[model samples]
Target: MKLITLLPILLCLFTVAAKAQDNNGSNPQEKKVLKLINALPEIIASNKLRMKKDPQRLLKAYIEFTPTAKDKYYQVSVCDDFADRLFAYYRFKVNAATYAIFYDDFENGKLVPLKVWQKHAYGIYSKR
Candidate 1:
């Protein structure tokens, strides 16, 4: 009788655990952020500087959450770390929901859309 009662309890516990595991992958926004983060390195590499005169192995990259009241996104940054000093090569924001990208145009004090930024990137990268 005790074994019979314990069997149902064990089965219930197992079902709850299985459902918890299933719920972990159900968040769509998390999946998008993970996918974009994985691909950012390759995207940055495509536009990297290739001057023979410049030093090699000086660039490092990071992806961070950009805190906001309503809008949410990830910030991808590639920086030059030389002699313990850091200089940002570029910073971009990718929307958490739509995956739209915006470049941080600090000089102009605005966020530039990826399409427009690409036009500027073409000239910067074409010479190399």
Candidate 2:
């Protein structure tokens, strides 16, 4: 009787463990992209980076990620409007398990870094 009851409990535990391992088995590149997305708020707050549109408001915007030729870098494009007129591009870099984010704005047909943040051992650092 006790064994029958514990069988269901053990099966549940195994199911949960399998799900956890499945999540952990996700692609490393995807995980890094997710980490960049999740760190936006903290990075903005820590660096006092200013944006034309409110970051929270921009959360409703359409976002796309493009991987760079370099393995550890990516280009993130965010469109704040349904018409896609208002858009911005950002560069995200991963170094030594740390992340660095940069705003890339085009001027005179050349991309320029407007703001920058690099994750440090203690905290995030701004390199504006």
Candidate 3:
């Protein structure tokens, strides 16, 4: 296969592998997520990490993570994956349970409900 033809497949496989593992390192990428989470109260408090719409940082993160904008799961999943990556960086040493909780929350698709927002109350709600 031509290099171009193989690229997308490789990117998808890479993304899946990366998302599936826990690096738990103090890398710059991990640090940035930690910083962003720290800076955002509702996000950290609600377990709601989101990328800015049309974010330049997120564009770069997507390339870094393997772009799959056509897939909503990938778009947000990658960002959520990074936040878990950052949390694990600190958590692996002292609180691995947190990592597991995070994984379960994400895999279960525990998203905040639209109703919660419409009702002006933040609560745990999941599509699953």
Candidate 4:
């Protein structure tokens, strides 16, 4: 009888866990990546930079910019190099499947991290 009662409880817990996973991808890392990718282009534009209609691959960039003429915190994601246009905006010399996030407020314009964005995106990532 105890096993019968425990079975239902286990199933319920499993269902809740599955739903959570559905809401957030099997790997939270991927979700974080998408969130970052979705906000790249606008950030670039807001910085007084112009970008082509597309990126090297797939990106849905956004930004949190001010109307005044001053640079602020920004985050960007570069999905791929399919269109060969990601670097056209930042004027950065990055390859593909990488992120070229720049922080105008960090270290007097020194591009930190240099790389390693894929392994530890969260370390440098910040959501709106």
Candidate 5:
């Protein structure tokens, strides 16, 4: 008798939980984009720490992002306005589905995994 009485309540709770997990049924791509956008501040903060020199010696460093063709990734570009010039710091390709990040290796002519990219970039940028 008690099991029967509690079953409807359990079903209602489960339905609510499922709905909450889906962001109220919004588009999946939109959710991914929003998640990345929301994380931008933390991302920029971390990259700032990787700088060998103070990128903000004259002005603040900032990061920008745009969806790549076909929307599979976001092209993340870093730059700073200093000394009356736009100084580009680095570029990254962020996966839309997995949120994985890759460094745009202009020197090597290929995208490199972030850990490898970081090792190389941080070597060039950070003092160790």
Candidate 6:
């Protein structure tokens, strides 16, 4: 009778374990950020974008600073080629898989929204 009672408990534990294993893909946001990082070279190659710092270095920093949850975000700034004046800033929302990019003239100290990129399903990012 004790073995019969224990059997149901064992089965319940096994079911919970299997469900946890099935939901193992928990880093979707990180993967989305990495996709953006990988696309940097292509974005620069098109001659449509410019950055003062090396793209690879910036990517490394971005990855390090990116947060895992929705409430936290990462921010970085870029200066001119001379590295003397801040020209742009980028804020990344990992949970939402979006970037809020801003540009500043440095003379007026005003930042204007340059673009917003949102990552969609299958790792495609679209400008908003």
Give each model's whole-structure lDDT.
Answer: 0.57, 0.42, 0.32, 0.38, 0.55, 0.39
Task: Using TM-score as the measure, name the better of candidate 2 and candidate 4.
Answer: 2
**Total clashes for model 6:** 0
Candidate 1: the clashing residue pairs are none
**Of models 2 and 6, which has the larger lDDT?**
2
Q: After superposition, how far is residue 44 of candidate 3 from its true place, in Å?
A: 8.1
Could you report the Cα RMSD, in angstroms, for every candidate shown?
13.0, 14.1, 15.2, 14.9, 16.5, 15.7
Question: Which model, 2 or 3, shows the larger TM-score?
Answer: 2
For model 5, the superposed segments whose C-alpha errors exceed 4 Å read 1-65, 68-71, 121-128
Per-residue CA lDDT of model 6 for 1-128, tens digit only, reads 99999999999987784322111123765455545544554334422334353442332213334444654543332222234323323333333435543332334444444442233332233333
Provide TM-scores for the models: 0.48, 0.33, 0.24, 0.22, 0.44, 0.27
Task: Report the C-alpha lDDT of model 2 over 1-128, residue by residue, as the tens digit.
Answer: 99999999999987784322111115676456545644566444533433454443342212243354554444444333335355433333333134455544333233333243333432234335
Deviation from native of the Cα of residue 95 in model 4, angstroms: 21
At residue 41, give the lDDT of candidate 5: 49
Candidate 5, run of 10 with poorest lDDT: 17-26
lDDT minimum window of 10 residues, candidate 4? 87-96
Model 3, residue 96: C-alpha shift (Å): 20
TM-score of 5: 0.44
Question: Predictions ranked by lDDT, top down?
Answer: 1, 5, 2, 6, 4, 3
Q: What global local distance difference test value does model 3 have?
A: 0.32
Q: Using lDDT as the measure, name the better of candidate 3 and candidate 5.
A: 5
Candidate 1 regions off by >4 Å? 1-58, 121-128
lDDT of 1 by residue, 1-128 (tens): 99999999999987784332111124666445445543554345543643334555344444545436675766656565567556667777778657787776656666777777667644242222
The reply for model 6, stretches above 4 Å from the true place, is 1-26, 40-43, 46-62, 68-71, 75-128
Candidate 5: tens digits of C-alpha lDDT, residues 10-84? 989777843322211156654554455335544556546646466453222233444567657665555555575
